[model samples]
Target chain A: MRATLMPVRIADDLYEFSVKDPPEARALAKALGDHPLALEVVAGLDRVAVQFAAKDETEVSRWLNQVAAPEVTHEDAADPIEIHVKYGGDTGPDFEAVCAALSLTRAELIELHTSLVHRVEMIGFTPGFAYISGLPDDIEIPRLDQPRTRVPAGSIGLSAAYTGIYALAGPGGWPLIGRTDAKLFDAARDPAFLLTPGATLRFHER
Target chain B: MLHILTPGLQTSLQGTPRTGYRAFGIPYAGPADEVSMALANRLVGNAPTATCLEITYGGFEAELEATCTLAITGAVGEILLNGTPVHAHQTLHGRAGDKLTLSPPQFGARAYLAIASGFQAQSHFGSTSTYLPAQLGGHEGRALRTGDRLTALSTGQATATLSTPEDLIPVFSDAFALRTCESAETHLLAPRSRDQLFNTNFVAGRQATRMGIELTGPPLEISGDGLMKSAPVFPGTIQCPQSGIPIALSCDAQTTGGYPRIASIARCDRHQLGQIRPGNSVLLLRRTPDEAVREGLEKQTLLKKWLGSALP
Candidate 1:
């Protein structure tokens, strides 16, 4: 896999390097051991955001130069976990709205949503929240002009070419179109989060 | 032995935030002002991340169930122990059953009340810091209320007189300088707007919350009209929505936003903005990532030095 590193400064001592994709990011993360800087691999469909702490600008530039083209081991991608969802209606108030905008029926929407295989881009916003990419073009929908004051936890929504499931209930503006009952986040759990960057997911209509 | 006579406004138990929970959208909410909180904690011989009362705009009055060493930091407010004048930011030894009353703040917002051994609260996600939105962490996941009796841990050490005076307490002001770096959307704005952001002074809007602080100033115009894709956001990100006004994301801010971010405040200076109340004037200055990191490290080093010197 070809990898390109782009050095971006977050702060005086905090710097981030955007690797072109996951294979390169995984490789670089392994090569750097016990570096004082905190390493974060921001998951994306085709790219990853590699962030680290820097002592200074000079150190950041030097580290970027030294770590370019680091060796990495490639492993077989994990099997996509199938998540069940109840789409469109009271549980998914925005479901019909989304279908109407796309001029598709409820069944058609469900088929399109379920057919595409998605990769976990990044988990953020709240605990266990997953940003899954790889949606079909016809289903892409824009976010609501006015965000909902309260979106129930586990409410799945599609907005602006991306889809994600909420881990916790909070004020969200995303156009939610479905709900999932699976417990994606539990502090009491050993793993804490069920989804991580690079995890693949497939949706099944419950 | 603080007895809650009235919880007035919002009060909660907080400490250093839980780590490794960022992936779950949980922020390390600990104290808004780490320096002040640390100083208060040190004054009473409590752990640096020990639970303490984070009182906002004070009017909280509690009867002291027992004598203990206490220190108040952040906003400048009238503090009275047993209806007598008490200094802030210095250790005070109160008699058992003394009633401590804190009047509304005259300047600044949020105050830290630290006692020896710290206040005891249930730990959630490895922290006592309360994230109100999730209804998790802190004392029962809610703000302190009247008639709430908070238990304090035993220090087993005698209270010592504080050498620092009340007037010398560290007080953050409204006219604070905020450090910023070019954001991902920086290129999206007019080239001239880049220079204008620093030159323009933005006033804090009344709609400030833990999630974000809205700035009211010269409206910033974006060069591009097309909507940008959503991206991960952190505290200090300055996002410009269609409103033309810029909003600075804070601790309780959303992890991702679609608005064009003109700049991001450095991590260290984020706290300075966090502590500012409504109507506070903020001056934004552009700094290289290197400068921001150096300043942050320097601040951290100074805090460590202060902690070392204060501890017995």
Candidate 2:
């Protein structure tokens, strides 16, 4: 897919250029690494953020333009992880409200959520918390009016047009629909995080 | 060995970050004041990124369960070894059964304790730095409590003799200056506001943490419609939320945020931000990218020089 590069500044010395697509960003990252400046590639689904140190905004802008080249597709694509979840209970306090809002039974909602494969668009909020896209339109739910003081780790939640899994217990406003047993983040592991942007994920009812 | 007789405020282990995991939404959680932390490590001849205790607001009392060399840096606090005064930045040999007491800091907020061979703690994400929210890193993923004992990895070398006078130790003071550079959202603010930003003195608000340091100042009006889609944020980012008050991101800041950033504090002056306590007034000076890079490089060179001299 064709992608456009957008130059964005993160800090004084840190300038980032985001590619509209992942392939182009990865390609740019590979090419830019040969340059004297260090290049950090932060990949998202539709965009890839490349950060570098620069002397000025003009120099950073020039570098960003110079690095924008033809997209190179990755040979080894990201793998999809399948996760099982127990939906609707005290663990998922907002599950019933979500089902009622969607005019569907808990079973139907589970079927809808499980049927479609989701792509990880981004990861944010906390460690290993993947923001997955491509959820079924029927399962879309709004976030809570008041964010819970603390969201338990592995709590699967939905808000607006996105679905996410919380890796750490912290304050969040997303509507809880289920809980997953899969440990998304384990610092002891070699890679640390199992899910990366562009990786696919499928949810199943336990 | 260091035995915690009393753990005051909050204290945890910290070191250089475990990066390359930010894509997983994990922040590279490390020492808040990296420069100071490195200096402490250097004084004790430990690796620059070695794990150390990050004590906040002091009031911590520990007994030297075994003889060891240690150094403290960052905040200006009273340190006593066996009820006698001890220097904060210089390495000291604590004998077995010696009691170390740290009173509340008279200036600044946090202090770092570095051992000769560094503190031995469990590794998380390849580092001992604690990310408290995730309950990861440090000793069992939490702060040190009373009666907790910490073992120092065997340090064959003795304490370094201070070439510089004791008074030369970098101590905290109220008159610290923070440096800044224009951010992406600088254009979104009123044209005159850019000039006003450098002219205005802002106060550090109570709502501050490792995640972000919120500043209270004259409300800055901007022409932007609303918050943009969440984008990656780094330390030194000066983000203005709906409240219009600017907040500077710190070590534990989120990977991404939707707030409009006004300016980013320069890397050289970030330590000043870390040392600032609530209600402290700060003046923001505008800097160009070139100026920021030069300053950062200069700071790095100084750090390297100090490290080379301090280490065996």
TM-scores, each model vs. reference: 0.85, 0.82
Question: After TM-score superposition, what is the CA distance of residue B106 in candidate 1 from its true location, in Å?
Answer: 3.0
The DockQ figures for the candidates are 0.35, 0.38
Root-mean-square deviation of candidate 1: 3.8
Residues A1-206, candidate 1: write the lDDT tens digits: 54546656543433445554545554554555335544433332233334455443466467665556566565557888888999987779888888898898999989988998887766677667787777864455766644455789889998766788988887566778899998887766787777776788899898
TM-score of 2: 0.82
Candidate 2 lDDT over B137-210, as tens digits, reads 88887989998989887855687655323433566765556779888678888877777788888888885577
> Pick by TM-score: which candidate is best?
1
User: Which pairs clash inside model 2?
Assistant: A20-A46
Candidate 1 error regions (>4 Å): A1-4, A21-34, A39-61, A69-82, A89-93, A137-140, A144-149, A204-206, B124-126, B163-168, B172-175, B225-232, B253-258, B293-305, B309-312
Worst lDDT 10-window in candidate 2 chain B: B160-169
Return the interface RMSD of model 2: 3.5
Q: Per-residue error at B303 for model 1, in Å?
A: 5.0
lDDT winner: 2
